[model samples]
Target: MYYLPKELFFPSVSLAHSSGIIALGGDLSPERLQLAYKSGIFPWFEDGEPITWWSPNPRMVLFLDELIVSKSMRNILNRNVLKVTFNQNFRDVISNCQEVKREGQNGTWITNDMIEAYCKLHELGIAKSVEVWQDEELVGGLYGVDLGHVFCGESMFSLVSNASKVAFIALVEKLRTENYKLLDCQVYNSHLESLGCREIDREEFIEILKVEKVDS
Candidate 1:
């Protein structure tokens, strides 16, 4: 296991453990966070735990053109009951993500420090969010780091059924129009798989990131 030093740096993704942890013990400064995403790595650890950085072997991602919108979800979007906005209420969105309970989880990984750090990134335009409004109230939203060509999704929450899905679909549509290459979901979950997210080798992911970095 590698421990990060004071200087901003990360070991190769190839050095990551089978569990995907590359390094531990680093502050979540915007600079470090930016570098992490640019390198196909991300931070994920619970509150009170040392910051753990990971680059999973089989990275889960969504190519912009491959987003899956089910018929039921299409109906929900067509209803127009939910309004979607970009970067409108980042603090609230992330706060909701931190507080919203999840099945099989005792506590949230979005700690106070993590919120504060991400909020800072949001201020700098490196982090972005999508808000879903119902009856003019915030019901669902998601947030992530935006790296020009790739959006690294961090977390999302829904107070109502299909609300988060609305935010995600809206974001995907927006990214598609803007010519984004992919949406980085980091790791996999059934929910993401249903939305057309699939895993590719870390090398493939890293190569894409490299090409994106050069193009941008």
Candidate 2:
């Protein structure tokens, strides 16, 4: 792996490992994060670890048209049990994502620095949050950076069962309406797979990123 410099740049995705780690040891400044997402790279490291950048092979992504919403989830959406909003409480959404304990994970990757950096991006309209509210209380949500044609998801949290799913479905519907080309989940998980996210060659993903955007 390569060591990052003070400048907001990364090595070629072709140089990344099989696991997609492209480089290490960089600060999570907003500029770096912006450039990273724009170039199809992202930072993912646990607290106290050196900032690790990744542009994984077999990139996991969801095209808006390929989204899968189960019949059960469709029924739930029809029931209108939750209200979904955009950018209503980005900080709260990220804080909840940071606090939620997930299976097999002892700690969160959404460190304080990441929270601050993403919040800064949110302030500049480069990051966004999808909030799921239940009876005026925050129940579930997700946050991510908007890279023109691609929305790079960071993290999500759910206080109740299926709340996060509802938020994700809402976000996908909105993205589709807005004509987004892709939803970059960064890595794969069974949950995302169930939602119709599939892996493509990192080079293929990079080619899409190169041609699908309006601007940074």
Candidate closest to the true structure, highest TM-score: 1
lDDT for each residue of candidate 2 in 110-182, tens digit (9 for 90 to 100): 9999899999999999999999999999999999999778889888899998999999999999888877889
> lDDT (CA) for every model shown?
0.93, 0.91
Predicted structure 1, TM vs. truth: 0.97
| Model 1 CA RMSD to the hidden true structure, in angstroms | 1.4
Assess candidate 1 and give its lDDT: 0.93
User: Could you estimate the TM-score for every candidate?
Assistant: 0.97, 0.97
Model number with the top lDDT: 1
Q: How far out, in Å, is residue 165 in model 2? A: 0.6
Worst 10 residues of 1 by lDDT: 207-216
| 101-143: candidate 1 lDDT, tens digit per residue | 9999999999999999999999999999999999999999999
Clash pairs (backbone) in predicted model 1: none
Q: What is the C-alpha RMSD of each candidate to the true structure, in Å?
A: 1.4, 1.8
